[model samples]
Target: MFLHLGGSTVISLKGVIGIFDYSLTKTNHVNNYFNNGKKIIKICEDDEFKSFIITNKEIYLSPIAANTLKKRINSQNFTEKVNILQEHPTFK
Candidate 1:
């Protein structure tokens, strides 16, 4: 499954490591680390991101809230489980 961060930015959930709240990255160490990295991708145009999505390839600044992103992940997992269950020989 894929997660729409913002704008035209969409990433695969399989590569995602963690989703962190924006405020959590406000510390000097966190801010400096992310800001200095060239691999950091900001999804929104402005500095109004709500969360940080750390993936295998790069770090993404998403406009969506952390809680909301977690919910999306859970929803995807639930859908996959449902599909698996339906495909089981016992269910058929």
Candidate 2:
């Protein structure tokens, strides 16, 4: 599944190692990660910034809030479950 990180940015859920709160994740810490060749992609919505970090060698700064992204993840998980059930013979 692919998660929309706001704007044109979307990432594969399989590669998402972590989803973190930007307030707790310091800028300097992210910069340090960047220096190590970890790619950083920022998705901005207007001027507001509520970034979520996705690290799987690369770090993505999503414009969406952590809580909101969590909700989306949960929703996707639920959808995946439903799809799986539907594909099963017992479900029919």
lDDT of prediction 2: 0.62
Number of clashes found in candidate 2? 0
Model 1 gets an lDDT of 0.70
Q: Candidate 1 lDDT, tens digit per residue, 1-70?
A: 8877878988887777667777767466566767665498888855788888877779888888887877
TM-score attained by model 1? 0.71
Worst 10 residues of 1 by lDDT: 82-91
Over 4 Å off in model 1, which ranges?
35-38, 78-92
For candidate 2, write residues 1-92 as lDDT tens digits. Answer: 87788888777777776676565444565455557877667677535567656557677766777768777878777344211110223212
Say which candidate scores most in TM-score.
1
lDDT of each: 0.70, 0.62
- Candidate maximizing lDDT: 1
